[model samples]
Target: MARFSYRGRNAQGQEVSGDMEAGSADLVASQLGSQQIIPLSITETETLGARSFKFDQLFAPRKVELDELIIFSRQMYSLTKAGVPIIRAMRGLQGSARSPLLADILGKVGDELESGMSLAGALQQHPKVFGAMFINMIHVGENTGRLDKAFLQLSDYLNMERETRKRIKQATRYPMLVMIAMAVALGVVNFLVIPSFSAVFAKLGADLPWPTLVLIATSNFFVNYWWAILVVLTMGAVTVWQYVQTDEGALKWDRIRLRLPLIGPIFERIALGRFARTFAMMVSAGVPMIQVLGIVSRTVGNRHIGAGIEQMRNGVERGESLLRTAANTQMFSPLVLQMLAVGEETGAIDDLFEEVADFYDQEVDYDLRRLADAIEPILIVALGVMVLILALGVFLPVWELGSVVRS
Candidate 1:
């Protein structure tokens, strides 16, 4: 018998780890399952030792991408819709998941299921992997006997979210590339070209223009202290990343994100679209309006929008109309408000929310389609201005030197 190391959560959702004598890692996982432990990982002792020898492996985090979740959801939907037992479907998924992180999660969920935990309960053990909205929908589906439908809905939402995010990233790509190129060009001029020019001016023994003097000093600092500059920039970025993970800092930044130039409206539309779609889907699935609103509030990417949703939830709790609560927040445009009012009057609120989501989707698509057109002109103008500044700053002194030599 070979010894294998296993890490898992017990029935109480607490982590448990140990080594067991087994024929294989799979056998170890089975033993853990029989012991009511949800196996997270089961590896041969030799493999464990080898992993420990790699120092970088000890510190590296497991990353689960959105695309992986999208694929997993679709797979789950197909399996469940085909009438396969949830356990069998989970086991199949665990074996076939492309992402190691996702495979590990599915394996643990399977272990929990083997130990008689409800699917939602098993998923709840890893809140970060399955968000509150996801778990809630699953719970609703399990209770409603529509697990297949829930996964199908989740797949659609995730696909839409992914596409929307892809569009935003694509829209920003050109500008990001332009900025990086500009930085590289500036660095080249400062490090290579500027020093050569300064050396020539020094040999000429002529007093330089103020712009040339400024450029020379800037180049010298960069040449001497590039490491310090790099360190400062890295520290600043790390600090911002850490701060943005905090609730208050995240809220502040999310609010600022909505107010940013050029992309602010796009962000607003995306947030509203997410809110509307989630609300519509959950409400249509027989989830209580209050719970639906609460879930939607927490999942919206923008904290400002989330806060508005929470406020609307609270207002609804106080016996106010959904339309009134939504309108009072001043979050929705007049057209959306009108639609909500009509939906309320007609008792077709879910359908109206769906329409609202669709409207925002189209609006966002239209804006994104023209984003390059809007940004390209600005980029070109900015690039021209930068070239003009560099020309005036660098060439004026060279012209002065030429006039002196001629005289």
Candidate 2:
């Protein structure tokens, strides 16, 4: 047996470290899980007489991407609903996993289960893969003994989210393509076509028109200083990226993005949809209403919306109705607030939230379509205006030269 050193967080969120004799790191992790410790890292310890040597090898954090997680959740739901054992289901998934990370996570989960750790406790160890909301839902499911149904609901929710993102991407594709094409055309004209024409006009022994002169100068600048322009743009992008990484900057930017014209409504809908869906899922899974609001607040994506939800959470904690809090916030529309109020009155808040989410999902789709239609004409007109200016800049000089020649 080899001695291994491990670090982990216990159930109380306290960090703990120790050495154990185990067959492998996986075995060590499984043993720790059985003790209600979520193992973060494990390393082999070697001793050479009086000298001690330690080499640390950290396990990669388990992170299943949205697509993989969705697929796994759906499959698990199906198998479990059909009365398959959790262990057997996980083993089959681990064997079929194309993602090494997912496979490793599933293998570890199975090992932990074999070592007598509850599924929820085992999942809690991998917070990077399964977030607090997800783990809480699973814990509730375990408590209620409806893990399969919960998994199915989570799968459906994730699939809806995936479809929403796909539609948004699709809607933005035309604008992106047009912008890229415009940039490429402009670059070619400035760097190649204009420069060649300028050289020929210069050899004609006639004073070049002012518009042509300006175009030539611009082309020359592009040809000679393109690298400098590229460097500046790259630096600007990197600076913005770094700035947005800060908490305050990210919150500020998210706030600004939510207030943007034409896009703001879409963003608002998307955030609300996420909030409603997540809140519904949490509530349906038996999470406390206050905790549900807190989780939903964090998941809203926009700081303004999250702030509003936070206020609503505080209100709910103070015994105020969720509908009243939502209505007072004024972030949600009247229809949504009314629906929530009715849901509360009927003691079906989860179902109401689900309906709200569905409504906003449809609204988001409509907004995307409207935004796409509006932006296409605007971009086309902008591109046309740019081309017109270029044409005038080049041709105005030629017209002046023609007048001079005729005189």
Q: Estimate each model's TM-score.
A: 0.85, 0.82
Q: Name the best candidate (by TM-score).
A: 1
lDDT measured at residue 42 in model 1 versus the true structure, 0 to 100: 80
Candidates' C-alpha lDDT: 0.87, 0.83
Estimate the lDDT of model 1.
0.87
Candidate of highest lDDT: 1
lDDT digits (tens) for residues 1-407 of candidate 2: 57677787878887767565567789888878777789888998943243443443145434677999999998988898899998899999999997889998888888766655667766866667887667767777888989998898878877887898899899999999999999999898998889877776676556776667788889999999999999999999999899988988788888888889888889989999999999988887788888888887876777778889999999989999888898888889999988988998899989999999999999999999898898988998989987886897777766766776798
The digit string of per-residue lDDT tens for model 1 on 1-407 reads 66666678888887866555555778777756765788888877664233345776576457778888888888889989899999999999999988767887888888767765678867876667899789988999999999999999998999999999899889889989998999999999999998999999999987788888888999999999999999999999999999999999999999999998888899999999999999998998999888888999999888999999999999999999999999889889999999999999998989999999999999999999889889999999989987986787789998999988998
Each model's RMSD to truth, in Å? 6.8, 6.5
Clashing pairs in 1: none
Given candidate 1, what's the lDDT at residue 183?
91
In model 1, where is the ten-residue run with the lowest total lDDT? 45-54
